[model samples]
Target: MSERYEYVPHHLLRRPVRDIATGVEGELMAVINENVSDAGREHWIELAYIRRTCGREFTTAISNVESVG
Candidate 1:
């Protein structure tokens, strides 16, 4: 089962879903995409959330997720 997610602003969460899904879905449809695994994909989604909420450096933000968890 998936872990519970905390609530977030609608504007913050909604944009990334639409934004990331657009690229993800397009790649899935064409079937030519490469370099992103399922775990990597999930990380990117989380990265979007990090970018939206923290406005910090992507590499730095991604590194800090381990501390949060």
Candidate 2:
């Protein structure tokens, strides 16, 4: 006599769950778990946040100063 199921922790179950454009750079967070029940129906861990950073930042410094040692 055991039948009780009420638990959902897949990053609150929903929100923008489709983004896997691979051009790898930065800002990538992922957690995926897929196991379709076989008496072990406790598997749903999917949380993904990805943003490939190519935001461009280049700084070059050139100042005339005499200091050689």
Which has the greatest lDDT? 2
Q: Mind sharing the TM-score for model 2?
A: 0.21
Model 1 Cα lDDT, one tens digit per residue, 1-69: 233233223332223322232222110011111223454343222233333243432221211222110
- lDDT at 64 for candidate 1? 22
Q: Global lDDT for candidate 2?
A: 0.30
Residue-level lDDT of model 2, residues 25-67, one tens digit each, is 3333333333334564544323333333454322111111111
For all predicted structures, in order, the TM-scores are: 0.16, 0.21
Model 1 residue pairs with clashes: none
Residue pairs in steric clash, candidate 2?
none
Candidate 2: Cα lDDT at 5: 31
